[model samples]
Target: MTQKRISKELQECLTTPPAGIKVNLVDEGNIHNWNIVMDGPADSPYVGGKFQLLLVLPTEYPFKPPKINFKTRIYHPNVTFDEHGSMCIGILKSDSWKPSSRIPNVLTAIQQLLLEPVPDDAVEQGAAQKFKEDRKAFDKEARDMTKKYAK
Candidate 1:
């Protein structure tokens, strides 16, 4: 049941992909893992950067939320600035996730996170504090990180 649902969502995302985002299964026979590439949105520090991500669906997907992690480094309040780049997206949380949610919506929510980081619910406390207290410095650091890692 999980495989069938994942396949359906994968096909839907492929057929009607979100702008600046592309995704593909890691293996043709396996529907549990996906590779994603996202272009950073403009008017933000990450503009001009292309970020890679991994989306792993558990065997009980639809019943459990998918795990998304940045394969590439990024500097944002909601995304940890490290190799793991674990993100803090509200929609992906077990508390907020719904079985009705689809891959496209998840990707869209990620994009929105890039455009607007939620400092109040940050994964990286320092980054969140900087983002909330010093917008200019935060943008500069994020842009620098983008150039170093995402470019």
Candidate 2:
């Protein structure tokens, strides 16, 4: 059941992906893992950067939300500043996630996060502090990191 649903969602994403997002299977033989390439929004500090992400679906998927992690490091309040680049986003949270939610919607939400980060719910405290205290500095640091890591 999970496989069938994932295949349907994958096909839909491939056929009409959200703007600035591209999706592909991580391994041709495995449908459970996906590789995502997301272009940073033009209006954000991450503009001109290309971010890579990994999305893994559990066998019990649809009953559970997919796990998404940034393979490309990003300097954002909601994303940890480490090799792991674990992100904190509401839609991916188990409580907020719904089986009805689709991949495109998830990708769109991520894009929106880039455009407008929620500093109060941040995973990276330093980044959050900078974001809240010094907007210009935050944008500069984010752009610098994007150039360094997301290029």
Candidate 3:
């Protein structure tokens, strides 16, 4: 059941991909993991950067939300700056996630997060505080990080 659903979702994502986002299977035999490449939004600090990400669907997917981590570093309040690059997005939250949610929706939400970081629900508290208190510095740091890490 999990494989069938993953295959179906994978096909749909490949056929009708979201803007600035590209997704591919990590391994031909593994439908559970995906490699994603996303172009940063023009209006954000991450503009002109290409970010890589990993999305992993659990064996009990549809019952549990998929996990996404940035393979590239980003200096946003919602995304961690270290190796983990963990992100905080509303839809991916266990309580907020729904079985109907798709990969495209998740990618789109990520793009929106880059455009406007949700400081209140941030994963990196210092980055969030900087974002709220000093918008310019936050943008500069984010852009610098995007240039350094995000190719």
Candidate 4:
């Protein structure tokens, strides 16, 4: 049941991806793991960067929200600056997630996050502080990191 649903969603995503986003399976035989290439939003500091992300759907997908992690590092208040590259987003939260939510919506939300980060609800305190205290520095650092790691 889960595989069928995932395959359907995957096909839809591949055929019609969200703006600045491309999707593919991590492996041909596996339908649960996905590889995503998201183009940085033009208005944001991350522009010109190609970010890679991993999205994993559980066996109980739809009932459970999919998990996404940045394979390419990003400097953002909502994303941890570590090897894990975990992100903090409202839609992906289990309590907020609904089975009716689609993958395209999730990908769009991620793009929105890059365009406008929620510093108050940040996971990375340092980035949040810089974002809140010094906007210029934050943008510069984010752009620098985007060049260094998001290339």
Reference-based TM-score of each model: 0.95, 0.98, 0.96, 0.98
lDDT tens digits, residues 1-151, model 3? 8888889989988998899989899998999999999999999999999999999999989889999999999998988889998998889999999998888889999999999899998889999999999999999998998889887
* Runs with alpha carbons beyond 4 Å of true place in candidate 4: none
User: Which ten contiguous residues of candidate 1 have the minimum total lDDT?
Assistant: 23-32
Best model per lDDT: 4
lDDT of each: 0.92, 0.94, 0.92, 0.95
Span of 10 residues, lowest total lDDT, candidate 2: 99-108
Q: Can you tell me which runs of candidate 2 are displaced by over 4 Å?
A: none
Please give, for residues 1-151, the per-residue lDDT of candidate 2 as tens digits.
9999999999988889998999999999999899999999998999999999999998989989999999999999999989898999999899999999988889999999999999999999999999999999999999999999999
Candidate 3 accuracy as TM-score = 0.96
